[model samples]
Each structure stands twice: as structure tokens, then as C-alpha cells.
Target: MIPLLFALATTVAGPATPVDPTIARFDRCAALAKADPAKAAAEADAWRLGGGGLPARMCLGLAYAAQERFGPAAVAFEQAAREAEIQRDGRAATLWVQAGNAALADGDAGKARGFLDRALALPVLSSAQRGEAFLDHARAQVAVGYLDAARTDIDQALALVPRDPMAWLLSATLARRQSEGPRAAKDIAEAARLAPDEAAIAYEEGNVASLLGKPEEARAAWARAAGRDADSPAGRAAAMALAGKADAPPAP
Candidate 1:
């Protein structure tokens, strides 16, 4: 969410003849949201009362997100998005994307789905931004057990952002879940190539290799995952998986 907000802020043009005071404040507030979320949230509230408009609301959302208070973050982002829409601001779609991400983080996949779809429905997003929205929508679909819907959205994301390792990783995971072993293998291979050192990708590579009946490859991948970060969830899971299967006979 910080990355998204920063990206948006970087693209805003400054005021006439000099720097835009509001934009500068927004930028400073974004930094504060990362460095001091509680203070940022308090200042953002005061800024909003002083008519700081979309930027103030967005900073408020960012502050909440930084604190992992995702429900309030989603509410703030949604309000900003709605106001942006009313103003016909081109940034409205991106704000909606932020709201959707916050909703997803808060474990409200249904709400996330609607918000992400709203972003996708808008034509204001760049190709990369649209791809991101689709990818997030796919995640929301997955959270709600709509695997088929997720597959469609993920495919769209890949079409637009084929270079994104995360997209390939999700595609591979989805393929594996659907029992499409060959597709899973292909997707996971790409994901591994793109993000060779990522423990999560390596862990998924192990899963895909196992599905493809390549126990040796699975073990090797899992070993790499565990070696990469023994404390991480993926690394720990990979270590456990490798231990469970290291001496087992190959699947028939």
C-alpha cells in the first residue's frame, strides 16, 4: 500500500510557478505514514478537517495500513476513492485498488472483490495498474473459493504483466490446485527463474515438482527454500515437507 501511494504521489504535478503545497504535504505525510503511522494518522485527521481533500484521506489510509489496522484503512481509502470519483480524478481507480487491498488484508474478500472489480471497470488505469488490479481480483476470487474466476483474472494479469514473478507464482499455484500438472510445472519454472532466491517461489516449485512426479527435483527445491530463510513460513514449511518425504518411496 505504501508503494502504491508513493507511486501515485510521484506522478502528481506540482502547483503553478513553484511546488504544490498540497502535493508536498501529501508526500511528507506519505513518508510519515511509513515512519510514524500513529502521528501520521493524527495529523492526517487534522489535515482533513482543514480541507486537505483526497491527499489527506489517502495519507490517513496509508497510516492505518502501516499500523495493520486494515478495516479502518479500507474505509479511509474507500472514502477517498469515492470522493475522487465524484471529482472525476484520474486517480480514483488506484485509490479503489488500495481500498480493495486493505479489505483483502482485513479478511473481507467479498468486499475486496467488489472494490477490485470497480477499479477494473474504470478505464483510468494504466496497463500495468490494470494488471495489478486483475491480479488482486484473482486473489480475492481465490479467497472466496472461486477458483475458476481466479484463473480467468490471473490469466488476464499474466497477459498484461508477464514479467511479474508473483503473477507466475499464483498461476502455478492455481494450475496445481486444478490438477493441471503440466501447466503448473511450466508456470512454476518461470516463477523460479524470475525470482530464483525467493523462498516462497522455491517452495511452490517443490510442490509443482512433486505434482509432476519428480521427487528429486521437489526435494532439491525444498532444500533451497529452507536454506534461503529457515525462519520464514515458506522456508519452515519447505523444511517440514522435505523431512517428511526425503526417505519415502517415489509415488506410483
Candidate 2:
């Protein structure tokens, strides 16, 4: 699930402004973003034109993200981050992370790396937030083939949030990339334990099983993933594996 940045209680950094009643409207738009992205985006756009400011643009960005229009969402979020910076708001780091996440989703690793670098340079992030930032930055690094740097970032993330399934999954994936079979198997096992129902975890377990020379275990794990959600990428990959196609690397 996407982090709810707007709902945080951190004090805004600029001169105090009276709470705008329109904030409720933007919140409503955001609340409906996934369920009705087109409507939410339209509402947010209209509000932005009427001088709704940062929150309105953020709502629009979320709406676009819900529709998987990640490139446009990154643009909106980057704009909001710049605006927040000019106002000296503490929300700048969160906005930068959102932009980075959108860019990553859009498969623009360079932009994601730049935005995440900005977020990490900010001093306002809480411990948990910093962990997430590191994990995301690591994802960007992995995309750009910086495996060593990704390992360092993910190590920091795991230090901060040891039980995070995503972080474990990423760790396992990176271990696999580095040809650390024992570590990959161990980490993927932890990820699977943490998120038993996650198709991606099952798929990764299969990968680790294959690497460990347990073909039967790999087939079983892959079959489990394929049965769980046939339309998902993990499911498709599992199916491909079952069809004698060469196994590919698991997605993060």
C-alpha cells in the first residue's frame, strides 16, 4: 500500500496559514483515487485551476498513480515537492519520495534515483520513513545495475525494519543476483514466511529452490504461485517456468 503522506501530523514549515476548507475536498478526491481515478483527477485538476495549491496537486498525482500513469504522476509530484521546498515545508521529503516512486513505477530509473537522492539528503525523515527511503533508493539502484550500492541500501533498510517482507524479498533477490545461493535461499525463506500469500514471494522461493538444486521444490513453489493469481506477473512467470521456458529472475 502507498504511504499516506498527507495524513501525517508533522508541522508544516512555512508561515502558518489557516486551514483551507477545500482540503476536505482534496482528501475526498484522494480517498476515491483508486476507485475512481478519472473522476478524482478531474476534480483535482479543477481544484488546482482554482488555486487549490499543494494538496490539490498531490491529490491529482495520487489519482494519476492509481491509473498507472506514473510518468505524469511523477511530474505532478516533483512540482509539488518544489513548491513545498519554496515554502520550506517539512513535506518536501515525502513529496520527493512520491515522485521517485512514480518514476520507478514508470521504469525511469535515472529519474527515480535523482529524486530519491534528494529525499535522502533531507533532514526531516523519521526513522521508519528513512528506512523506506533507503529501500526505494535501493530499488532504483537495482534497476540501474548498481548491485553493490543496492545491497548497502537494503542492508540499512533491514537494520531499521528487520521484519519488512519487501525488504527481505529485495535482499533475497539481490543475493540471487550476486550468486549467493545460500543467502538467497535463507532470505527468500524469511520473505515467504512473512508473506505466505504473496505470489511474488512464492515465485522467488521457486527461484531459490532452483538455485539450490531442488527441482521438485522449485516446481511445487512455482505451481503454487501460478495457481494463486494466473493474471499476475509472478503467476505468468511461474507458468513460463512450468512450460519448460528458461527461468528468469524474479521481480522485486
Candidate 3:
């Protein structure tokens, strides 16, 4: 779940403008996360040399997060949020989202909620921003055991961006948590439809199938997911589940 926060941050883009060195470094770090986190951290360190602006600080926060340094990540994100506030840019909403995620990763649901609330208060955010905020809020709600609130937020996010694979994945996650197997399956299926190349959706579908007692279906879905992104958490979970049932074999 904490990793999902990282995923959310990776998907969001900042405003288009002259390349702010901090944001350029942040983008580079984001790109490196898929290939080489060590390189990403090095880039973030370089960005830090220019000395802590909102984007640079946020990149540092994410770099720490990628390294599983949650405490420092949260602190960096908090500082970034303060800086963004001082700058009073609407884009600061994105920083708030990142800070909320860092807080969530650190197991501070109260802090997560506070940061998410600030993100939601941003005036006239674009649909993408609103969707991201709702997604982060949904994740925070889930952390706090507010199942109903999580459902509402995720649903709203999906409505705002029906084609977003991550939104559907979040919906599937919420449904699974509620023990609504059919709904989870539906959400995962939609995610697969929207993002045919995304292995995560296939892995989610596998989980839904397994939960619904369709072991053969789960096996097939997991296999497809594994073929797409062998390193993703979804792929790992599917592989682990399959491995546990290796002796018994998948049901026909």
C-alpha cells in the first residue's frame, strides 16, 4: 500500500515551463526509479546541491522514499510543502499530494490526512490534479480504516479519469478490501481493458479470480501479469500465491 503512494507520485506530471533544474532532476529521478534507483538518488543529491526549492526538495523526498527512508522522506516532503505554500503556486497541490504520500508511507495517517486536505483545498485544480488528490485521499482513508470514505474517494477519482489504469487499480483494491470479490473483478477487468500493456491490472485480476475461488483463471491471469512486469508488486504477489499452491496445482 505504501508502495502504491510511490506509484501515484510517479504518474503525476508538473506544470509545463522552462525546465526548472529541480523539476528536471525530479523527472529524471522518476524515470530512473523504473530502471536504477541508485542513479536516481545520485541525481537527487545533485539537485540538492542547488539547495532546496519545492521541486528539488520534493525530488529528494521521493528519492528517500524509493530507498525506503520514510522518516527523512516525510521531513523533506514537509519542507517542500512549506516552500510551495510560500511560493503560492497552484502546482503546489502536487507537492501536497507527495507529502501526504510520504506521511502515509511513514504510518502517520493524521499527517497524511492533513496534507491531502491541503491538496483538496487548492483552487480550481485541473481534472488530473483533482483525480490525483482524490486517489491520494482514498489511499489515506484506507490507511485509517475508513473503508466507506476510501470507496467514495476512489470512485470519485475513477469518475474523473475513467481511462486511468491506476484509478481502476485503486478501485479494485478498495473492492477487495471490502470483500466484494465480484466488484473487485469488475474493476480489475476494466483496468485491464484500459491499460492492456500494464501488468499490474492482470495481477489484480488474478487476485480477484483467486479470491472468487477460480484458481485456473487466477493462474492464467497471473501468468499474463508476470510476463508483462515481473518486478511489480502485483507480479510478486501473484507469483507468491501461485508458488504456495504449486503442490496442489491450479483448479481446472
Clashing residue pairs in candidate 2 are: none
lDDT of 1 by residue, 1-252 (tens): 214464344443555456667888988999999899999999999999999888899999999999999999999999999999999888889989999999999999999999988888899888888888888998889889999999999999899899989899899988888889999899989998898899888888888888889989999988998999989978888888988944221110
TM-score of each: 0.90, 0.89, 0.71
The whole-model lDDT of each prediction reads 0.86, 0.86, 0.72
Candidate 2: what lDDT?
0.86
lDDT of 3 by residue, 1-252 (tens): 223223222323556545654455566666675467666667766766767466666666777787877767778777876787897755566667777877877888878888888878877567877887888888788777888988888888887888788898888867876779989889888888889878777877777787788989988988887788778866676677667743111110
lDDT per residue for candidate 2 within 98-210, as digits (tens), equals 99999999999999999989998999988788888999999999899899999999999989878789889989988987889999998998998899999888888888888
Better of 1 and 2 by TM-score: 1
- Arrange candidates by lDDT, highest first: which order? 2, 1, 3
After TM-score superposition, what is the CA distance of residue 226 in candidate 3 from its true location, in Å? 2.8
For model 2, the stretches where C-alpha displacement exceeds 4 angstroms are 1-5, 8-19
Per model, how many backbone clashes are there?
0, 0, 0
